[model samples]
Target chain A: MSELTPLNAIGEFALINRLQAGLTLRQPGSVLGIGDDAAIIRPTAGTELVMTTDLLVEGIHFDLSFCPLRHLGYKAVAVNVSDVAAMNALPTQLVVALSVGPRFTVEAVEELYAGLRLACEAYNVDLVGGDTTASRGGLTLAITVLGEAPTGKAVRRSGGKPTDLLCVSGDLGGAFLGLQVLEREKQAFMADPETQPELANYEYVVQRQLRPEARLDIVHELRELGVHPTSMIDVSDGLASEVLHLCAASGTGARVFSEFLPLANPTLEAAAEFNLDPITCALNGGEDYELLFTVPVTDHEKIKNHPDITILGHLTGKEEGTNLITKAGQPVPLKAQGWTSF
Target chain B: MSELTPLNAIGEFALINRLQAGLTLRQPGSVLGIGDDAAIIRPTAGTELVMTTDLLVEGIHFDLSFCPLRHLGYKAVAVNVSDVAAMNALPTQLVVALSVGPRFTVEAVEELYAGLRLACEAYNVDLVGGDTTASRGGLTLAITVLGEAPTGKAVRRSGGKPTDLLCVSGDLGGAFLGLQVLEREKQAFMADPETQPELANYEYVVQRQLRPEARLDIVHELRELGVHPTSMIDVSDGLASEVLHLCAASGTGARVFSEFLPLANPTLEAAAEFNLDPITCALNGGEDYELLFTVPVTDHEKIKNHPDITILGHLTGKEEGTNLITKAGQPVPLKAQGWTSF
Candidate 1:
């Protein structure tokens, strides 16, 4: 019970003013940031601009009952930045449009913005402009991130060649497993209000679910190691789905080695506890925010020793079809059981 | 009733495929469009990139009962484009993110996208990227527009000076009056379903409300006339509000002559029919999507004879305060009763 000001009391202008007061423009290209009809930025010459947008609807993409507003805000920006990284680009700026419900107080909005600002700082991106309005149903966040890559340097999903080594950054299945843990806790709490849910044991997995970071570090490291991914896409829709996307875009097929699929220890332990297959989770669990990419076979040696990079498989001709080779030496057609909002 | 396919029937990816099938990328700088994690574009050298985003929530921004889905889609793009035009920039691309509800069908989404494509063609801005997801409540659209202006050529609201002649493109009060008429008709229809709405006489105003176009033509005309506006803003939230915005941004005051305010005859007639003051409607009516700007006194002759342009008044020192010179020879302080979503 603390005194809190409702958003309606101060009006839209004052709310905007409060939200923008702490923003500091640090991007060199940002000529004008906020406080205008539009934001102005000067994109550097000889660089291609990479842009992506993502929309997260309440009750569809997240459940506020268990999800913190700050984490929601962070995830929104991180997901967009992940898209930027998928293009082999460095995110420079972002514009967020939010539709907040009447139930949200000024303090709640401030908390959300604080997370957004923190993500901006972490990603080295500036908050350029956005629009905020009232929502009749639930809160919605739509974020558009602007990034830059040197001319002819952007790695597209269509660039993978046959026999290219497919690689993935960091471990997978943790986020999806983390979500399961959170949902279970939520259900348990609902059944008995006095019961305190135990989440400390699932800290690593839960954090992965709540505050997944974009794999910008992998993008930077690849560049530093003199390696450019032949094809790239962020793993937002599970490894199996993303592998298929890269293959389809490149007019090829892929053979993913089940043994090589990276799964965190916590993810495996949680999968066993839940009576789920860790390998299945690794293949089809989404929201890892990791980079799934392909590199020419000749450059594989340069990336093989990298602790964060895992070589998962190789591309094949179209006739070969997309398949996941089991540890038992059987080939099964890869199925894309990615999340469907519908 | 005709058979229709629900959105969930085809799922998110297939629906996206259907919607993007007809999109043709016409921008030279567009290196990538859709189907990837992010879109890529090569911004022209030495030009500032102008970015803006707007969120339109159903029930909050529009009434689905009367507002056609097609017009909602069109207005979403046009309003974002209007912001780019206000910055004195040419809109080059847009990314639209939409959250639809379960009630939407594949055909309904197609209709919405058809309208979006039509607006993209009309505005000559490429549809580069977007996100599509499901919502639990009403449909929501968040659009981000990217435009470009030559270095140091983008106009800002803070550049106005004292004695600058304020001008507006097209007539005002029509859109607001149109909303009023639509609401009245809706009430009447609710009262008696058998009675049809008598909207033939209010067609012009109704169209203004339903499909208001952004004044990009005025931006081009001013450029062609060799007149760079000292300050400019789109009249999205009424004349009084926008006038006050320019004043506050520029640290100056403004005098808007009530007699010189642009009002369509149809709007005036509608106001009389509703027993409302025409002048008040002209001053407080929002969503005209027209351009309100100021030009140096020396360039007045170049724009005075333009058929769509109307010179209202002039800016004054901050101490003079923003006011409207009444037809009765008395000046009244301008009030910003702008639309508040809160």
Candidate 2:
């Protein structure tokens, strides 16, 4: 945000020291934080550790044209936090490995770390340790999040059973529409450098794409309500792909009701503007980062009235196969057409 | 090594499935390994967790011209493990995040995983979870390693006392010399496509460069010998840099005896061939992944006879400052000059 300083000017250790200077450990489990060969954490006596990693490469994962460095940094940590939430665990510590090309300035890196620090505080997770290195290509970030859940209480995608209610947290398809809006704006900007693309109407979708939050709240609320999910996963790859994942992992089939799929007003508006069906977008539009979990049918009433949750379907016998029940009573096979990395 | 198959042909999920199929959890702490949103681990009672991360960028940290994918994979994991060893911990689990460019094939990815698996077995650590994505440039790897040590037993870089004896594990400078040999061979190969590497005489150095091992054995031996290091760090950067880190962190100074620095015969030969000083290679030729530590002077006799360790020097009061006692008995201030990332 200020004067640009080449990374080479300060050197690696100096950069690390500068970035690590203001970090404070807030987690009780954090025995040591940063500045050592490794950070140390003392896990709670009866808790198990849930570890997940995500690698986000520039161009492939985000474009610098519309995606600010700060937002990219926040999203990187949030995505991994979402995975931890999917496990029904509370994130405790995180380590980041950042690789930056020469084009990046010290101030740019600080802004990215500022976003990371914000996420760390939001999640109440400690920034324990990390590696910072130079890259020959664009910026890349790899984050590994460590979380904890009561021993044997962490949910897995393979724990669902027949007759389990499939529930999803929050509305979907916003992130996908958000991407479409950004892409359109990017195209306009590219066509004319002086063009001031209008984006006021797309604020919600844009935020969904640029700064998606992890559904840790859903994990917390479920615990508070005395409801234990039979199986859980995050809607990172869309509702359809995640439901399929649950079914395959748990050896059960699911019937998702198309009409019951939650749609936010902004998402519907964006879908209409883009000439797309809101239901299809909700089903296959990925990067929502919402929690999708299955609870025993008996616990349905406990969470049914939750403001942010929607009961989308129920698990059935594996022989039934996974499908989406249309509003007209037709059964359509579900397919996983989520985002592909390669 | 087999018929090459493009990565996109099989898709991401299929690729993950293929890579994850044969993974078996060996660590008793591993409650779950792979396939879930996150891997789960149960730390042993009364032990603290040590975590560290490392990012390896293509072209910057390594050149694929002479570096095999498998060795690259192994080195990535080993380097993180080395950091764990630096904290006096036993590595238990690892997570990898890989970004590969379009030029890479699925089979090539398999080769990389094969190397990862080999390292996992060698280190007695479990390959628990990872993220794999396509890169827009050359391959990049980020690894996070988790290890455990008895409560309050894990060493830190800030624990050295003024009178502590500084020691190092194994011979140094070999890996640096190895890189030199490989780079020379790469140049020759590039100059004439028909050129053979003629690497018979430089096997040891070449291996050191391509596949450096972590010094976990030193950690175990120190434990068994009833000798605890006052301070410890991995010599990822050269000895000079690492010694300075110890001094700065411990609020003390150190005197490194150049004559006492251990250099293997092969390393010496390579240094001679390159017309470089063996001492300089040992001091500033990094990538050795050896352990640099300081132990209480009283415990020196216990480790002095150990085959792999060399007592390099002793810690000094802060006023003395860090310096290297040359072979000719002149004291010179030690400068890092280790490999710079930026």
Give the poorly placed runs of model 1, Cα more than 4 Å off: none
Q: Which ten residues in a row have the lowest lDDT in candidate 1 chain B?
A: B276-285
DockQ of each: 0.92, 0.94
lDDT of 1 by residue, A162-194 (tens): 999999999999999999999999999999988
DockQ class, candidate 2: high
lDDT of 2 at A211: 99
Q: Which pairs of residues collide in model 2?
A: none
TM-score per candidate = 0.99, 0.99
lDDT of 1 at A142: 97
lDDT of 1 by residue, B131-179 (tens): 9999998899999999988888999999999999999999999999999
Instruction: Put down candidate 2 lDDT per residue, B74-177, tens digits, no spaces.
Output: 99989999999999999999999999999999999999999999999999999999999998999999999999999999999999999899999999999999
